[model samples]
Every structure is written in C-alpha cells, then in structure tokens.
Target: MITLLLADDNPRMLAALVQLLQREFVIVDALASGEEVLAKSDTVCPDIILLDISLGDLTAFQVSDQLRRRGCPSRIVFLSVHENPEFVRAAIEIGAFGYVFKSQISRDLVNALHAVAEGNQFFSNSET
Candidate 1:
C-alpha cells in the first residue's frame, strides 16, 4: 500500500481526507502544521505528502523546499482551495507531483494520487 503523510491546518479537512484516503493508502501520519511535517518527515518517511498550501508556521512551498534540501524522497502534493494560476505554477515549479483543489477533491484527488504515484503530474482541471 502507498504511504502518505497529510498536513492541513483545518481539523475537518484533515479528518475528511483521512477518511477518504485511508482505504487506498496507509496514512503514516497526519499533522496540522508545516512545522510538524518538517519535524516528522524523516521519521515517518512516507511515500507521498499531501500538504496544504497555507500552513500555520510555514507555507507548503517552504516546507517542500526544506524537505528537498534535506533530501527527502517523498513526493509532495499540494492540497489547496486556491485555484489561482500563480499558486498552481508555484507548486509545479517547486516540483510538486500534484495539486488538487479542495473544491474538486472528490472528483480529482484519487486520480491525482494515482498519477503521482506512477511518477506523473496531476493538476486540477482549472489549473490545466
């Protein structure tokens, strides 16, 4: 099974994602802040990390960059409500494997995960 680490500030969003993805993926850890993600990443060593763009202590981009600097091999996927072209572009530039908008989670998230796991990029329709 694929291992995943989920980081989102909203408790409900985290819970909902966990519920939605637990069957298909093993949730190595679920955290509420980018700080926690950065701190726990080495230990959990998840296959993929679903990160919220707007985090409490650090932005997802910052976390992604730090993880890369630390040589973390986990694929990073940005989960955000923002559909701004800039945000999508930033995520891609940061080497994110996927970007799933919250509004289209039910429709696109699973497909995104599958694509990323297969070493391909997945972006919401609006982003494409």
Candidate 2:
C-alpha cells in the first residue's frame, strides 16, 4: 500500500482527510505541526506527504525545503486554503509536487495525490 504522512494543525481537517484518503493509502501519520512532519517523516519516509501551508511551528515550505536538502524521496503535496499565486510559487520553488486548495478536496484531492504519487506535478488552473 502507498504510505502517506499528513500535516495539518486542524484536528478536524486531519481526521476528515485521513478518512477521505485511507482507501487509497496507508496513513503513516496525521500531524498538527510542521515540526512533527520533520521529526517523524525521516523515519517513516512515506510515499507522499499532504502538507498544510500554515503548520503551527514551521511553515510547509520550510518543511519541504529541509526534506529536499536531506534528499528525502517522498513527494510533498501542499494542501492549503490559500489560493494566492505567491503561495503557489513558493510551493513550487520548494519542490512541492502538488498544490491543492482545501476547498477542492471533494473534487480533486484524490486525483492530486495520484498524480504526485506517480512522480508528476499538479496544480489547479488558476495556480499556474
């Protein structure tokens, strides 16, 4: 099974995303902060990460940059409520494989994950 690590400060959002994605992946962990992602991710090394942009202690962009610096192969997908182009550019610069707005979860979350899992990048139309 595909393994996933999720980082979101909101418990409800974490739970909901876990439920929505469980069928497609084995959730290694659902976390509330970017620190948690940095701590557990190296050991777990999940196949993909669904990372929230506004993680409590560290931002998702920082988390992604650190992981890349460490040569972590797992793909990072930025899951955010922000639709701003600046965030999109930052995520891309940090090598996030996907940028998904939380509002589009019902329609696009699964597809985005799939695309990222396949070593491809994905973003909403307005993101580019």
Candidate 3:
C-alpha cells in the first residue's frame, strides 16, 4: 500500500482527508502545521506527501524546498482549494508529482496519486 503523510492547517479538512484516504493508503501521519511536517517527514519516510498549499507559518512551497534540500525521496502532491494558474505553476516548479484541487478530490485525487506513484505526473486541472 502507498504510505502517505498529510499536512493541512484546517482540522476539518485534515480529518476529511484522512477519512477519504485511509482505506486506499496507509496514512503514516496527519499533521496540522508546516513545522510538524518538517519535523516528522524524515522519520516517517512516507512514500508521498499530500501537503496543503497554504500552511500556516510556512507555505507548502517552502516546506517542499526544505524537504528537497534534505534529499527527501517522498514524492509531493499539493492539495489546495486554490485554482490559480500561478499555484499550479509553482507546484510544477517545485517538482511535485501531482496537484489536486479540494473541489475535485472525489473525482481526481485517487487517480492522481496512482499516476504519481507510477512515476507519472497528474494535475486536477489541465492548466499545465
């Protein structure tokens, strides 16, 4: 099973994500802040990271950069409510394997993760 580490600032959204993904993937941890994610990611060593784009304290882009600097091997997938083309461009620039919109999660998330796990890229929108 694919192992996932999730990070979102909203408790309700975090819980919803866990509930939605737990059956299909092994949720190593679900964190509510970027600091917690940075602190635990190395130890948890999840196969993929489902990170909220707008984390408090540090943006997901910042976290992703730090992770990459640390040579973390986990593939990144940004989950966001934002549909801005700029955000999608930023995710791709950071080398994220996938990007999923919160609104499109039910329709696209599982398939996105599957595609990413297979070493391909996926985006909820075709903006790229």
Candidate 4:
C-alpha cells in the first residue's frame, strides 16, 4: 500500500479526504496545517503527500520546497480548488508529481495518486 501524508486547512474537507483515501492507501497522518506537515513529514516518512495548495501558515509550494531542501524524498501531489493553468504550471515547476482539483476528486484523485505513485506525472483530466 502507498503511504500518504495528507494536509488541508478545512476540517470538514480534511475529514472527508481521510475517509475517501483511507480505503485505497495507507494514511500515515492527516494534518491541519502546513507547519504540522513540515513537522511530521520527516518523522512519518510517507511515500506521498496529498497537500492542499492553500494552507494556514505556509503554502504547499513552501512546504514542498522545504521538504526538498531537507532531502525528504516524498513525492508531492497538490490538491486545490484552483483550475488556473498557472497553478498547474507552478505545481509542475515545484516538481509535483500530480495536481488534483478538489472539484474533480471523485473523477481524478485516486487515479492521480496511482499515476504519481508509479512515477508518472498526472494532471486533472479537465486540465488536460
């Protein structure tokens, strides 16, 4: 099973994601902030991180960058409501393996995770 670290600021959304993903993947931890993600990522050593693009204290980009700087090997997959092309491009530039739209989670989330876990890049179908 693929190990995952999940982070989102919205409590309801976070809980929903946990419920949705737990069935398919091993959820190492579900966090509520970018700082908490940064603090626990190394300790938990998840295979991938399903991170919300907008976090309370730090953005997903910041967290991803720091994780890279710290030599953490976890792959990043951003979750966002934004469907802007620039956001997708930025996620790619930051070396994200996948970019999943919150609106399209039912259609794309699991598939994206599978693709990313297989070392392939995945973008929301609507974006492609």
Clash totals in order = 0, 0, 0, 0
Provide the lowest-lDDT 10-residue window in model 2: 119-128
* TM-score on alpha carbons, each prediction: 0.96, 0.94, 0.95, 0.96
lDDT of 2 by residue, 18-128 (tens): 999999899999999988888896687989988999998988889999898877889999998898889999888878899998878887789998888888898865532
> Candidate 1 versus the native: TM-score?
0.96
Candidate 2 regions exceeding 4 Å error are 126-128
Segments in model 3 whose C-alpha atoms lie over 4 Å from true places: 126-128
Q: What is the C-alpha RMSD of each candidate to the true structure, in Å?
A: 1.4, 1.8, 1.8, 1.2
For residues 15-66, could you state the per-residue lDDT of candidate 3 as single tens digits? 9999999999999999999899999976877889989999988999999999
Relative to the true structure, how large is the alpha-carbon lDDT of every model? Answer: 0.93, 0.88, 0.91, 0.92
Q: Give the Cα-based TM-score of candidate 2 against the true structure.
A: 0.94
Give the C-alpha miss distance for residue 92 in model 3, angstroms: 0.5
Model 4 residue pairs with clashes = none
Tens-digit lDDT string for candidate 4 (21-121): 99999999899999999999767778899999999899999999999998889999999999999999999999999999999999999999998999999
Error of 1 at 78 (Å): 0.2
Which pairs clash in the backbone of model 3? none
lDDT of 1 by residue, 6-114 (tens): 9999999999999999999999889999999999977777889999998888999999999999999999999998999899999999999999999999999988988
- Superposition error at 45 for model 2 (Å): 0.7
